[model samples]
Each structure stands twice: as C-alpha cells, then as structure tokens.
Target: MSFNSPLRDEELISKQVFERMVDIVGTSHIVANRREIMSMTEVLNRSAIKYDVPFRIATSGSMGEGFRFEESDMDVMEYPDGFQVIWDHSQNQHKSFSEGEIFVFDGSHSPPGYGLLQILSPEELNSSKLLFVKYGNSYLSSTFWKKTFLNPILGSRIHGPCISSNLECLDFDYAECLISRCWPPMASTFLSRCQLWPNPQTLQDIVNKECHLVPIGHKLGNHEEEEWMISFSLAEKALVYSMNHSQFLLYGLMKLFLKEIINKGLDEEEEILCSYHIKTAIFWTLQQGSSLECCQRNFLKCFWVCFELVTKWVYEGVCPNFFIPENNMFLTKCHGSAQRKLFCRLNAIYDVGPTCILNWLSMQDRSPSLYSYLRGNTNDLYIKELYNELAVFALPRYLNFQTCVRMLKSIVKSAPSNRDGISALVARMTYVSMLQHVAFQLMSLKKEDYTRDNNFDELSCLAIMQTAKLGSVSDLILRAMYSYRVKKYPEALFILKMAKVWLKQPYMIHFGYLDTEYSSEIAACPGNSLLEVVIKSFVFSIKLENPIFYIDELFTEQEHSRKNHWSTIFIPPFVLLLMLEFLCYRHVDTQRAQHALDELFDLMHSNQDSYLTSVFQDISWQILGICQEMAGNLQIALYAYMKSLVEPIVNRIRSATLQRIQSVKRRMCRI
Candidate 1:
C-alpha cells in the first residue's frame, strides 16, 4: 500500500497539505533528531555551570520546545537550586538538601493550580528578603518578585510573569520560579487519563519530574498578591517531544494560526486567545485516545478536530487546563461578550475551513503566507527548511573540557541512529573537531613536559584529521595564529597563503545564508551541494565556549570586560582568518600587511555575501577597529569603535569599546 493510503484521491487538497508540511518541517525522525540535538545543547550548558551557584537557569517555553515564532520572546526560567516545586512538606527529609532552607507551600487558600509559598526556614532568614508578607504565615508574595525584576537599566520590563529584556539579537523573557520536588495533588488526576496516549514508561517519567510555581498569581484569586501559579513546564516539554511528528507539526501550525490569524492586527491586550489554550486542547485530545487520529495524510482533519475542541471551549467559556481540570484557563479573558467575540471569530474561520490555513496571510491583507510554497510545484526545490535548520546542530555548545568529553560521547553514540542525515554526519565531524579544540587548548596550558614532542604531535594529528574531513582552512588559520604568536612570521605567512586559497571557495551555507533572490532560481537550488560544502569544506566557527582555537589579538582587555553573562560569544570565522593575515604579514612584508588591512576594512564595512555579519556584527566591527589602531589609524579606529557601539549592547564588548575610545583619545592628546 502507498503512504497516503489513509488519504482518498478526492481529498487532493488534504494530500497536498500533508506533502507541503513534510517539505516545510522534515520527516518525523528528522524533526525528533533535531529536537534531541537542541535539548542536548541546553542540558550541556546547564551542566557546565559551577556546582555551587544558588540558581538553576533553563530555557523553557517555545524556544526550548524547538519552535521559534517571529517576535516570540525566548523564555528562560531561573529558579532556586537544590529543590523543586509542587513539593509536599514530606519530601523535606530527602536528605539531599536537608541542611538548607526549606520552603513548604500552602495550596489550601489559593486555587487548584496555584499555591502560596511558606518559608519553613528560620524567621531571621525570611526577614532579610522582605518578599514575604504576614498573611497568617510568612508567605512569599509574587508581587515582591515583580518589583524585584522592575529595575530598568536597558529595555527590561515586566511582561506578565517574566522580565522581558531586549537583547541585541534575541529578546528574552526571564521568569523567576520556585521548584516543587513532588508532583501537585491538583494534577494527580491527569495521570489517570494518560493510559491511552503517553504509554506506561512516558507517563512514569512525567510523574517523576519536578513542577514549578511561576511568580504570577491567578488574577481573580483572593490571594492575588501572594499566590504562585503552578507550572507544568518540565512535564509539558517532555509531552511535547513524545508527540508524533504529525502532532508536533499541528502544534507548530496552531501556534502560527494563533499568531497570524487570530491575533492578526489585534493589539496584545485585545487578543483573548493564547497558545496555551491551543496546547491544552491538543493535550486533552491526545489523552482522550485521539493520538492515532493525527497522521500526515489527514493532518488537516486532525487540525480541524483540535480547532473544534477549542471552539467548543470558547463557546462554553470554560477552557480547562489539562493537568488541573478545575483551573479554567479562560476564566479571565473568554467570558460574556468577549467569549461571544472569540467564538464568532473562530466559528467564521472554522466555516472557511482549509482556506484559513492555506490563506492565513493572504486573507489578512494579501501578504505572503507559509502555504505559498504549497501553491508551487513540490519538486521545484526550496531546500526544505528543516534540514537547512539542521546546520546549527554541528556548532559547538557552551562547554568546558569535561562537558565536551561527555558531549563528544553523546554525539558519537547517537551517530548510528541518524545514519546518512547531514546533521548526524556534521555532528560526527564536530566531535572530532571538538577533540582538536581540546588539544589546541592543551597547548595553552602549562605542562611539565613542555619540551616533549608528544603533545604537539597529538595536537597536529587531530588538526590534520579535521583538515582531512572539513577542509584545512580553520585549522590552518589556527596554526598561523600560533606561529605568529611565537614569532614564526615566515611560517605563519606560508600557512595563511594556504588558508587564503582554501577561503576563496564560494561561501558555505548556514542560517540566513541565501540572499533575497530567495524565491528566484538562485535560491531554488543548493540542495545536495549545500549539504556537501557545509559538511566537508565550510569553515565552522570554534565557539569561545569550546575554546578550541585562540589568538591573543582576538581578546579585549579581559579584566574590564564583563563577559560572564554572555552565554556564548560568536566571532565570525572570516574575522579570525583575515585578522591573523594582517598580523602575520605585518612582521614579514609591509605591502602584504597593508593589503590584508584593506581587506579587513572591506569585510567589516561591506554588508555583502561571502561573510555573515548578521550574527557577530559588533564583534567583527570591534576587531576591525583594533586592527586599525594597530595600523596607527586612530581617527578611523574611533569611527569603527563607534560603529560597534551602535549595535545592541546586551552581550557585546561595550566596556572594551568605551575603554578603547578613552585610550585612543588620551594617545591622540599626547601626540
């Protein structure tokens, strides 16, 4: 039988929808593999932190769920370490953290999915924080947490439960939470309905994981100021991954629907419906034994089924939170006339049916829609976005030596399952390159046998192995940097000459690689060759977190720069390749050095192809200014520094830019 056996020939539109979805979001295995890779990255970063830090920071929400919606802020939850939320007072004897402060909660007064945190620790300890109110007991007020996050430095403001910060490239919403070790009694009933859907093992895992209490009280609740709403974020993330590819795609499509269709042109406060409502509807549908109903062939039917569920909830004015059936998610918004408005809108869209999905953007104001590609020939090639997304899986994670070792083992073990997938192959090459990085870092460390040739040979072997697999450009540039560092100018120059030749290849593809001729024929191609070049020839950046490759000239004044908050720093590969070119040639030949310097300015100033400045714009500009200063172009250096300052200031080297500006001004006065 054919794969579309469940779909009828008369249902041509449904079949097209299913195939288009496959092109938009790859095969189920591919999406699941990509999700695993992303989850692995977050886990590695969390583990890489110091053991004694008081807080545990994690990415939650849509970004962590492997979904990136436009303008949707990345959600990061920072909760107290050592313990978890929805915790029963009984688990205090777990002995894991018995010596530490214990925060028992009272759910008696608050609603089913919300609780009041009672500081069971010493009275003196609770006095210091001042976040507690004497409402019969020393209960923590979520209002206090709101005030704490309101310190305006940059463009940070309170957005619901989170403190939204405008980072240069990405906007982040940080929600401070308290973890409860035990599962909430309120959600205990949700497990009983799990028999048909989650399977025994997955259900057991959900029971074992911790839940959290986000700092927002139910607005209509009596203890509005103090109540902390229970969050099943940890459990939700697990459930989302356990979903079949069809379900995941439906969820993604539902999100797009909520954003583009339901909320289109509506002010934030005016849009009563939310993604959570849609998620709860899907979760209930899955538990009610509709899991198998979701399939690639009849996904449109499945989407409609889920949509009807939401419409029913809107009309009833009682959208149940999946975990705690008593927690009416629509309590505040979907009521009376508001409910009538939402129901009418969803009903009209329901009546229109597939046009709602296919004409999502066009129906609004004739804008381009995601389904526009579906209107074209399937074999006409647009690189099928999901695999293009897979390119990032090979980039190094935020890791140290030990974590890199663990990351390496994990990547290697998962290799067999991925088979011929581009991401898996790139991942294999990534682990080898990770070893090369470790060896390179070993060169910078002090060793008693510094004179021994063993370390050097081992390092050289790994470098050559990487060179053989993914071109010799990055490793060659790294070698030249080291050679120039130890005063081997002629050797460095020769290595760079080889690197320059390798660099001349047409730029390798990464995210946002193709220009706006995006729909034109130029963007239509790059399928197999794109994968081949990215795998075997592209210059993959050695993330600073990995510490594989280094040059002294790359750093700003270390002591003055507060780079700790920066999760990872991206200095584009081209900046390193050409910057070292300038340094190496300056020692050997003035004419060549001048030529390299000219190239540096061009790369920095030009917003052209061949180099991606979008990700590391500020850092690249800063590097150019540093090189200009070295060349005694003080005025031009100041101009370049100012350009770096103009970009977003969140993770960039702003202090270094400011200090350098002062240093240049002082030097100019001395002249």
Candidate 2:
C-alpha cells in the first residue's frame, strides 16, 4: 500500500507503457497538429481582418497546447486587433502601434502576475466594446472585459477568464485579451531557464512574440476590476511544441488523470485539481532537465514523480506559476481544508498504484483512443494518424492572397539561417496567390463574358501550369474548378485527365481516409515519401472567399450572416477532385459525367473503413447532391441530400442538406 514510486519489478510494465505512448503520441502528427493549428489561426485572423472583425483569435489552453479530447473545450483568446499595451513611457514612441489606443502597463500596485492597463494614447476614447472599463485615463477592467463575451443564446457563461459556450458540436471558451509586444520583467527567469529546452531559435521566436494580458485578475487582489493576468500562452505553446514524444504523452496523461478520475469523483465545486496546476508541475519537472530521467524506459517513473510533485505542492499549499515563481497559482484554493482534501484524494490514487495507471489509460478516446490501442492490434495506427492530421490539414481557411504575399516577403527578408525547406510549400503558395489575385481581378471585370477576355486566358494558362506548386492533388482540382466555373469545358476535361492519372496510381494521396480495401495499401505505402508527406501535411487547401468562389451548395449557408464565416469546411482532396470531375463532365460529356457520378457513389458507399481518412463527409455528400440536382437528376440529388443529412460526419450540415432535399423535391414536383 506504500507505493510512492514505480516498483523495481514493474519496469516491464513501464517499458510497455512507454512503447504504447509512442503509438499514441504519433511523432510526426504532433508537429503537424501544432503547425496546422498555428496556420489555421493565422488564416482565420486574415479573414477577420478582411471582413473587419475587431479581434485576432488564437487557440489556447489544452487544445492550443496540442492535446485534444472529446471533453476538451476549444480554448481561444481574442486579442483586440487595434489595442496595444506597452511596458513604459519610453515605448510611447513605438510607432508600429500608432493606430491603436495604447496603454502603459501599471504593475506597481497589481499582484505579481497581473497588471493594470492605463491609456497612454488618445486622450479621449469611446467604444461600446470597451465602455465598461472607461474611467479616469480609461483603465481597462478584467471583470468588464470578461463579461463582454457572454451570450445567453449560445448557452455561454463566464468561466474564469473565458466565456464558455456549447456550440452545436463542441464546447468553446473564448478569452478576451490585449497584446503587450515586450516580455514582462517578472518572467525574465523563464528566459534563463530556456537555456536547456526550447532551442535558441525557438527561444528567440518566443521572445519576439507578444505576451497577452488576459481578462483575469488575482482573486485576492483589491483592484479586481482593473487587474489583468499576464498570459504567456504563445510561449507555452512553443514549449509544448519542443517537447519530445514521451514528454508530450506524459502531459496528455496528466490531463486525462485530472478529468476522468479527479473531476469525475468530486463534485463540480469540489474539483480542486485543475489542468494548469498539473501543467505547472510538469514545467517544474521538465526544467529539472538532466536531473530527471525523462525517457521511454522511465516514462512511468517520470509520471509518478510528477504526480508526487503535485501532491507535494498540495501538501505545502503552493503551486508556483512556471514563468513568475512569485505567483502562487494555488494561492487561495489549495490551502487548509482544500489542501487536505486534494492530498487525500491523490494519496488514495497513489496507493492504487499500477491499477490506477491501467484504469487511466484504459478508457481512452482523446486523440486516437489509447483504450483500443492498448487492447487491440495497432498495425495500421501509423497510417491512420497520417490520414487524421491530413484531414484537419485541409480544413483551415487558405491564407488570403495578401497574406501569402506578405508571408513570402517576411520569409525572404528573414536571415538565411532562419529559413528552412518548409518554406518551399509556403513560398510556392505565394506564386499561386499572385495567380489567384489576378484571376479574381479578371473574374470581376469579365463577369458577363469571362471566356472572351485575352488577359484571363493568359492567367488561366498560368494557373494550369503552376497548379503543382500549390502542392497537392488540389493543384489540378482547383484549376479544374476554375475551368468549369468559366465554362471552359475542354480545359476542365484536360485538367480532370491529369487528375485521373494521379488518382490511378498506388499512392497515399487521399484527402480523407481511404476505403477498407485500400487500408492495407496505405499501411504498406513504402514510407509515404517526402512528396506525399508534404501533400498530407498541406492537403492543398483552397480558400473560397465570397459567393463567387462557392458552388450553389455552399452559398445558401451564408444566409446566417458573414460575421461568423470563419469556418473552413473540411472536404477531402480526393472527394473534391472527384466532385469537380463530375461537375466538369456534366457540362462537356453526359457519358463521362455519369461515369464520374457512379465512381463517386462507389467510393462513398465503401466509406466505413477507419484507417484510410479526411473530409467534411456531410459537405462532400451535399456537394454530390448539388451536382446531381444541377444535372437534372432529381432522384439522385434527393438521395445524396438524404445521405448527407444522415451520415456520421465531422461537422453537421443537416439543415443545409434538408434545404437541398426540399429544393430537389420541389423540382421533382415540376416534372
């Protein structure tokens, strides 16, 4: 019963657990997940700017840290786009933030990790979003700022610093914040600690990045209204990114323990252990570096040590913040009766020993399910994860043309040492961006008679030749979509032919998971190579801004207003390319169109397969229905719409699919 550490004989179990963590961590997928989230948020901010939304949104917390689960709330921080906070009066001349109302950070009276924002620019400012905090010199209030995000309609309520909501499918938590370009003086210890982990480049990147002032005050502080908690969310994400697979898995397991065991056993109000406390423990453990034997062989031992650290923190009544050691994160909560209660709960679990660890890892459904992987064979897990990341890869808004150009310029201007081959995919996207910008210009000008334009013809040809540079099967498919859009049937046919040549090969070029018949083929795909790897990572996503870029199927959904149009609908590259072929052929050759339709039906029908994956399945089916309806096949369109409404898919498109079905029925009545 006195089990404080992994026993000598349990080393075998520790090794097996370590090996299991390897499968669950999915090494390449970890980097891909962070990259995808970062890129996705980048493009989302771009759309927000284009559409005039006031805040730049970023994913934060557990999901932002790169470990996602069914229960994980999608944590987002919304930094007001035009607002800036500077460290001192000397920075008042920092012209880079000229347009925004600036604030001088006043930390003198505030708690260790929190500060007050005093307006430095615009002697007089007025805005409804910020009116609650308006006082002498207009100091921003954490209490007022956090309340602004509340919405009774979305079932949203204040959850600490965030406005938590249960969206249709998932729970979302949005935290309002302001960005301070300079790192805080109190967090300088973190800079010295970075000498061990988070390489020089990553450290530099973290330092250069802005620190956010989240709408959270120290609960015990007097200035609750005006205090803002300093958030190093971006820096923390970078640290998580640098973690080895074992460390990452351990972090995830800690989260699991907090949720399934701790929270499940205690009442909602009594749930004393939070993920942040666990994260602090991990950070403290990680900073131990050479002292801690953090590897596969000692994974369980490391986990146990981290567990002991948490228990120790509870016993001593202090869990220090990772960045600022002066900040006791558990200041009021984990003391006296609360401390005793948490320690007892943890000690009882510790006594359960390997049994507790087994139970923790048993009911998994976080990323890919550690439960089943622990029990069943994992022959196809590698390929399965590749497909999972690829599916998510395609679901972000494509960087707008302007963003691509700016990003390309920034990369070019960066030191040669800073540039890497990863930029090649992005660099080529800049070329496609110019072509895209020109095509949009020509499309708008030649709206009525697009085919007659000589300038459009030149750009169209360039779009065709440069498609490969965009880096996926989307290379051909996006061009084919353009050709079809302009009624260039022969050109669409030529692009489809090239697409078919790529499709016919024995390759892992799928946007979503493949059928069961092809699962083994994917698992045996000879390492999936560099080219396929790039395609899997990028998935050759296309951004469709305005109704002009959308087919008739997606246009109707915009009736909900363009304000919340940041959603990037997931569509598998293979599904999209095939749908485009069907669309193109219907215009040029009835026989070919029918053949394409049949091929699509076969592919969709065989889709119960797990290993071969990606796409917004419902949208893909809905698009099929639209194509069928456009072709005057009312019955087929009706069936496709029905399939879309009923199918198990990622994002629910039920209402839109229902509308399409109703429309199809009305057309059938006409017949």
Candidate 3:
C-alpha cells in the first residue's frame, strides 16, 4: 500500500521530464514576474498621490499563490481608498452639498478642500463624466462615491474604478486591475468549518490573517459577474511555498497536464476544465495521509494517484470545494453525464499508463504537428463535438458492436441460476441498447461535420444529450444489482421500480423533458419486458419472505470479480439495511443490524486500506456499539466505542467518535 518508492530510471528520466515541464510552463518565472508586477504597482501607488489617483493595486489568484502555469491569468484588484472631489465656484454657479445640506459660496472662487479636482485634465474630467453617465447611479458607493462614479471616465486605462494593466514578463502575460475595495477578513463560520491540519494552531493562525477579496462579482455562466469573491491566494502561496522541491515539481507536472493535454483545443465557449481544479485535487491529495512524501519519491505514481482522485470526483459528479467541503464546485458548471464522460477520458489516459503521457509530452517536444493532431481538430468543431470525439476515441477499439454482442451473450451463458440469468441478460441488453443508441446518433452526424468545428460541436451536443438519457437507467441497474447482491429485496425492488419509470420516460434526464423521439426509442426497446419480469419476481419474492431464492441470483460472472472492490454502490444498501433493522423496524431487530454490520465489516476488510475503508470501519464500529448498547451489553458496547476511536479517517468523524465514547462511558457509569 506504500505509494512511495524509488524511481526506476535512476531519477534521470524523471528529472529530465520535470525540467522539460518547467521549460514549457515557466511556473517559477510567472511567480517572479508577479512579484515584479507587485513592486511596480507599489511604486505606481506612491507616485499617483501627486496626480490624485486614489486607487491602490492588490493581487490575487494564481499570481498570489506565487506560481502559475504559462496560461494562468494574474488576478489584480484596485482599491479606492482615498478618493475625493473638489468644487470650484468660478467654473460653475453651483453650491456643493455636504452632510445632506447645500452651502452657498460668498461670490469668491476658492479651491475646494484638498483641491483634488486641480490635478485632473479637462479631457479626463469629460471622460469621467461620460463614463458616469454610461454606468449610471448603480455603480456609485457611499464610501468611495467619487472614485466609483468616476471609474468609467478614467478611460480604457482603467478597468472598473481601478487602473488596469496586462503585464508581459519573460513572455508570460497576466491581467491586473484596480477594484474599489480592501481585503475582507475570512468569514468566521467558513474558518470554523475548515478541516484542521494536524497542527490546528497553524491553521488558526492562517485564518486570523487578512486576505483581499476581488470585486469580480458573482460568477455568471462560470464567468465572474460584478461581485466580490474572497481571495485566498496568499494562503495558497504560503502552502505551496512550504512544499519541498519534489512536491512543487509534481504540482507543475499536474498543471502542465491540465493546460497542455487536458485543456488543449477547448475554445472560450467550452466549459474547459481549469487549472484550479487540478490545484484543488493536489490540495486534497496532500491532505490525505502522507501523500506528499509519497509524491516526492514516486512522482509518476503519485501523479497518477492524484489524477485518479480527480477522476473519482468527476465520476461521483462532485468536485468538492478544497477549503469548504460543502461547496460543490461542479454542481452548476458540469452535468452528471458530462462529468462521467470526462472521467472516462481521464481513465483512458490512466489505463494507458503514465508513460503514454510522457511519450505524448516527448512527441510534443519533437514536433508540434503530432501534438496538434493529438489535440484533435477543434478549430471548426464545437466543444460538445470534441468531448464526444474524445469519449468515443478513448474507448478501446476491441469493444466494437460485435464484441458487445459477444459480451452480452457471454453474460447469458455464465448466469449463476435461471433467475439470475434473466436479470443479467436484461441488464446487459439494456446497457448494449443504450450504447447502440449513442452510436446511432453519432453515425447520423453529417460526414463533413466530422471535421468541421462548427458542425461537430452542434452534432456532438445532440449526440451527448441523447447519450445522457441512459445515465438514469444505468444508475438504477447498478443500484439494483448491488441491492440484489446484498439481499435487500425491498430496496432492490424499489430501485427496479425507478428504473422502469426512467425506461418509460428517458427524456426526463434532468428537469426538462427531452424530445419525444428519444423517450419513444427507450420505451420501445426489447429489454423492457425482461426488466419487467425481473422486477415482478423480486416483488413476489420479497412479499413471500423467500428473499434467499433471489438472493443467490448473481447478475454475471463479473460480479464475483467486483466482490474485491469496495464501492459506495455496496455501502448505500448495506447502510439502508442497517438503518431499517436498528432504527426503523417495529422492534429493534438487533440480530438484523448485527448481520448488516458483519457484512459491511467483511467488505471493508476485503478491500485495500483506503480512506473509504477507514470510513466503513468507523461506521461499522459505531453501529455495532449502538446495537450492543441497546441490548444492555455495557461492556461490549464500551469495547465497540473504543474500537471506533482507532484510526478514524475523517477528522470530523473522529471528533464525533470521541464524543460518542464519552457518552458511552457516562452511560456505563450510570449502569
């Protein structure tokens, strides 16, 4: 289970690969360039006082982290700290308002307090006025009203209320802007929720430090609107700085993978995966046990491990917010089926091994043509089309239509019993039909559209939408399979019921209804009858209390193989059974709860040690303790509670376990 191992190629090859990545990304150069930009901004701020420019520049994003890949945009904010206005009676016969009252001048012209208006040229003033008119009153703020209102008048040189610059350093470019706000302290609630590092004091100290927020506004269509987003760039920088050289190199490699390989050919319109996701993956990976040390030794292995973690998140349809676990980064940005397709693409890379990526990178070094071809013809193709193509191309060539037919036939031949045989055939056929449906739509695309970006994107989007219709059906089939395996007849029957509904109305993938044609095709599929029979049998068996007859019905020979793999698919039903027997049943069925706990523990032990295994063990122990406590077995319950505290994976869970232990001890004392 130790991921850290000595490099096989005497570290020479890995070192060269790392150096080549550095050459391509210039991550270090970006960091230095950002520092130079910060220095220049400071100087600019000092000089601007004479000209009455009231804005100061602050940095955020990858630049704030002190390292960015070649493609990263440096996020800058301009704060309107000390902006004011001057009124002159000689220029206009008008009185100025102060504190909600107008004051009249005594027929003599005098410069207003601070004489701030004297520094601006007439053209600048005119531009400012025109901008104010364009933006209207909504842009004004009470604290920096003059600066906020005058931002538009500042011309193209100013972005919003702050001066803007896109600096070029060592051939890398980053956008900088002045926004009218100072750094905001981190929210106390958010800080409290953060997963504490081993050294809680360090995390506490970091949270107490102030960090700037960018007035980039809320995100609209994955693009920031005119709202402020908290910037943790400085904290991110400190964390990265603390990493050893090897850890830093691996991070750079990950960035290179995201930018050069994964994001290649994605246009502005595409929901291109960002480097932030890769960084977040790294952050999570590092937090899990001693993964950082593992990465330092087995760079390639650890790189793939991190990639797998990212793929797992994508598969689960959730990319958790690194700092805040509750914030699902992918919820709004990516659809479930789309995320699955992404996982498939990444998994394909993994299946081919890291050497393939290294080889691709090497080929890129030798010739741009090879890289371009590998990047695919995205220029004329839509992003949707590109994704479809990636998913299609990533599929193994061996899995052809005939091969699929053979596989389905093999499932029928290897069925454990008559009942299991029928169920297996039905599930396999449904899967095949779904695949065939996708293939049919893909084939229907115009031949010319295959190469043209415009047509490809449109065609691809249609194909993917059609393909997405299968997700619900597929999910239900898998759920039912697990439920059946675990002998949860009622749960399995419920899942099958859901599957039937989805089969009838396949168009209802999300909130909206898809075209009737898609639903009609699914409804008309031949597997529906077989699916119905399996569902009916399950219902009858569950009612008769003859769950054992159907329980032995294994879906396919492959199910035997999956016995070794610990998955959430298995955990859900097991947990459901536990909850039903222990908490919801008319009588607290201690025997049934014990049975469920046993099965869960067995599954956990069968799987390799992992965070998930730890979680499973923790839950199993807690439930066992509960069962013992309810049965008045104080000594056994105390032992189970003590066991629950052993090596809990999640910090939050560990805290809960400690409290539970204390509760158990108090109860035992009372007894």
Candidate 4:
C-alpha cells in the first residue's frame, strides 16, 4: 500500500465498518459511543493545549493495536467530529444480518451459538425500538434505537464497529475478554470454571465463577510468585492508566479494595494490611498528582489522614515524647510529599532544600500541615532563622556584657549578605551602647555599700553593651583603676556598681593573684629612666616624681634589695600608687603637693635610708614648697623649702642664695 493509500484505505475501511455497525447495532448507540469519545477527546485536547504537550493515545486492552475500528482504535485526522471519506458503507457493506455480521468481527468469527450481545440496562433495553437478532443464545439488538447507547468497555474489550481479528472461531464476553487480557493460571482457571456449566457458558458465568476445590499446583504457579505477579501487574497497569487518566485509576483501585473489604470483612491483620496499601496508594497519588493536578479533589481524604495522624500524636499522649517511632514515619511521608510538590513547583531536578524563612513563616499561618507540627504537635519548628533571631525578642534576659559582645561579633563576622543579618547585628550594638550609658549613670550614684544588688544593675548594664571597637571600654577601665589607687574607692566603684540599672544581671569576678604581668613590669623598673621609652611609646602621660597614691614608697638604698619585709613590700604597690596619682590628678593644688613632699620626707626618715639626692628631686621639692607658700601655708612651706635646701644639694643651694643676697647688698651700697 502506498503511504497515502494506507490512510485512504483505513478511512474507507473505517467508514464501511461504522456503517455496518450502525445497521446491526443502530445509529443511536453509535452516536452515544461517538459522544463518549468526543468528551474524552476534548478533555485530552484541552490539557494538551494548556501544557503545550504532545498528545498520544493508546489502547486500554489486550487487542494489541486493536481491530481496524476496535474499541481502542480512534480516527483523529479529521477529528472532533464527522468523517470526510468518500465511501459510505452503512448501506451496502453488509448483505444481510447473518452474513457479514460484525460479531467479534475484525475478520474474527464466533461459533454457531456465540456472538456479540449488547449488554444493556433495563431502561435502555425498554426504551430502545431497535431491531434484535439472535446469535447463539444471546440477542444482538439493532443499532437504531431512540435512547439506547454503546460503550467501548463492556468490562474490558473495546466494542467499536468494524473491529475484527484473524481468529475464526473464538467467542468472547466481558469476563472472557477480561480473562484473555491476563496471563496463565488466571486464564486457564477461569476457563475451567466455565466448563462445568450445563449450557453454553458466557462471560457472566465466568465472572460469577467461585472456587470450591483447592487450586492445583500447575494452575496457581508458586503462590508467592502469583501473588507478586498480581500486585506487580496491578501496579504497572495503575501507572499506565494513571498516565492517561489518573483519577479513573485511583477510583478503580479504591473501589476494588473497598469492595474486598466490605465483602470479606477484613480481620485485624487483613484490615491493617488493606489500610496500609490504601495509604500507600494515597501517597503514590500525591507523588504523581503533584504535577498533574492541584490536588483539590484529593484534599478531603488527605486532610482526614493528616489530621488524624497529627492529632493522635499530639493529644491523649499516645506518643508523649515529641519524637516517636510511628510519628516519624508519618512525618517522613508528609515531608516527602511536600518536598515532591515543592520540587515540581520550583521545576527543580534534584531535591530542593526546604522553604525559605519567609515562605516557611507563611506556611505556618496558612498550611494546616505546617501548623499542626509547628504549633500544637512538636516544639521543633526546624526553623534555624527563628532561633537565631530570638535575641531580638528576648527581654530582661540576663546576658553578660562579654557574652553580648561575643555574640554580636560572631553575628557580624559570619554574615554573608548586607541585608537583615547585618542590620540585626547593628541593632544589638546599639542596645549595648545604651546599656553602657545606663551603667555609668548608676555608678555615679555612689551608695556606701557599693556591692549592693542595686549597684550591680549599673555594672550589669555596662557589661551588656555591644562595641565594635575596644577603645571605649579601655578608657573607662583605666580611669577606674586610678580611682582605686587613691582610696577614692567610689570613683573606681563604677566598675561593679551599676548592676541594678542594667537590663541584665552582672557577672562576678573573684580577684585572684596579687600581681599581674603589667604590674610586675612597673615594679621592676621603679624610676622614670627605665619607663620613659615605654611611656612615650604608649603615650601615657605619667610623671614619676608625682607623689605615690596607692603605691608604698621606701627610702632605703637597699630597699630594692630588700626581700618581702613590710618596708620592702611597699615598693611595688607604692610605685603603682605614684602612677595612679599621676593618672588621677596629673596637676594638683600646692598644699596637696607639699603634703606629698612631706610624706616622702617622713618615709625617708622612717626607713633610715638616704642615697644620691638627684638635682631634679631637690628642685621638684623646692617648687612644691614655693607653691605651698604662695598658697599662704607660709610657715610650713618655708620649713619644707629649708629642709629641701639642706639636703644633698645643700652647698649649691647656699651658694645660689648668697649670690642673690650679695647682689642686693651691692645695689644698696651703690645707693
């Protein structure tokens, strides 16, 4: 046949066959079949148009490619309605009812007693005025009925007109057609049951067939294998059917199991197994339907299962712990479904990750599945973002300043984007700054028992302050250290005093070793000679000649050599005292200056130690004495100056004064 001829020939054959079909089965039934086909075609066409997908139709039975116009065969070239073929076969195709009759046609023939019998409901049989013909024992009703119709499926085979096969003598019915579609044991077993009938057995007889004797070995195959084949074939068919008509497959499967359950009244074990299989089917549907449909039709059943599972796990304490064995299984299934749907929606290939922060939060409000698990069901929201953001909501929560600083630092350091994450870090730092200010104000209050709980608030507040730079805290701490040197304990009191006003409680520090590394360095080098460079490098303006504040001064030459006796012990602390003094009061009033000089003298006398009185030291004392005299502590100031002049630089001091005195005397003589 030419390529185009096959098309023309198929059209010719289809027309001739359909006309013959109408003559025997009548035009009304053919029209009904046409209507059914049209409806299904429209559904397919619309879906194909919407998804922009190619369309292919396949047969639903074991007719292979189906007879020329078999139940499965459809002419789609001039589709959506009438044929344009020139040949009209309805009139001349069949000579009479018996010869060229289309009973299991497509060139296939039935035995004398068996042929195609139109299975009709009481209403259809009663209303139709179509002619009826006797074939075997069944009646082949005429096609031209008022309201009667034909269906492609009378259980299994497609019954469209002009369909036939090469087999000349086989006969069929719905059940036989159904059996023919199966392999081995099912077919033979079903046929054997029909053999027992007294009269000619038909398809209905096979459907109504029941078992009395045990199945034979060869007939059933290996029981396990048979069972496996049954389940496997069923699933294969379900998937194939699902590809074309998913809801129909679902309905069929659901109906079969439901009928089995109702008829057999499943025992406990069977009930569990049946329920489990049904549940599996539901999950399968969800997996497949995610892309095919929106699942609105599947919602009613899925919602019940989800609600039951979640509520059971949540309430009545069947599984008291948040995580339980059964609960995990259910959750896994749900999460799998969610992930599948999510993947489809994103059009992603590999398993996509979970919802983003915003999407998850939205789900919490809108999705019952999310709400049940996140809100009432389990404490674990599985949300990393919410926990990370908890610091924002937490209030009056005691967090040490060091802790606050550390947390903020970490947040800023790790953040990858210049978005919400960075903004949050900035907010934390601002809060810390506010806390520091409050802490300072509280310290300024200066209650007597500074260690009281109220005092702790101010210190606590300062502790929580977040800082991008360390310089601010460094300045405050250094000042506090000086105040401690002068016995101005209240000034240093701010360090721990502000805890009460703080948002969080303060952390306590237990003072340990008496000396630190910094202290040891200062003590080892007592004079400015050793410290000048370090001081300049650090740019800390401390003068060595200043009076010792917290430090204990010693006047012995051997003082540096002395071990840990009372006087010797004073050296390190006393030096620290002088540095503290410089730090607190770099410049002081004259009386206080003189008093500092007097304290040095007393210290020297008590120690019974004296060494080189440097010119600098003598001059420093003299200046202090003059400052005191200027302040009108004339007697004491004069005494201080006289003592200073009589010390190690005595001869120089006398000579200088005598020169000034002689100069005055000469001026008088001249007059």
Please give, for residues 134-157, the per-residue lDDT of candidate 2 as tens digits: 345557666666666544443467
lDDT of 4 at 403: 38
Each prediction's total of clashing residue pairs, residues at least 3 apart in sequence or on different chains, is 6, 7, 11, 35
Cα lDDT of model 1 by residue, 1-671, tens digit: 12334443535655556655564455565565556656655554454443535778766677566664565556778876744443666666653663445677788887778878887754645445545666667766687866764454455777778878855356778888877667777788978867887778888898888777888888888888778888888888888888877788788777777887887888888888888887888888888876447776677778778888888988999988888999998888889887898888988998987646766652234323334544753321333344334445445443565555556566656554544555455555556556655655555666775676566646644554454455435656656666676677887778777777776644333333533333343333456444453453445553454234356665553322335345445666678777888887887888888899899898777876456456566777887888889999999989988988898653457888898899889988999
Which clashing pairs does model 1 show?
84-179, 84-180, 84-181, 85-179, 85-180, 86-180
Alpha-carbon RMSD to native, per candidate: 6.4, 5.9, 25.7, 42.3
TM per prediction: 0.77, 0.77, 0.37, 0.15
Most lDDT-accurate candidate? 1
Ten-residue region with minimum lDDT total, candidate 1: 378-387
Q: Against the unseen true structure, what C-alpha lDDT does each candidate score?
A: 0.67, 0.64, 0.43, 0.29
Looking at candidate 2, the ten consecutive residues that score lowest on lDDT are 415-424
Candidate 4 Cα deviation (angstroms), residue 581: 39
Q: Order of all candidates by TM-score, from best down to worst?
A: 2, 1, 3, 4
What TM value does model 1 have?
Answer: 0.77
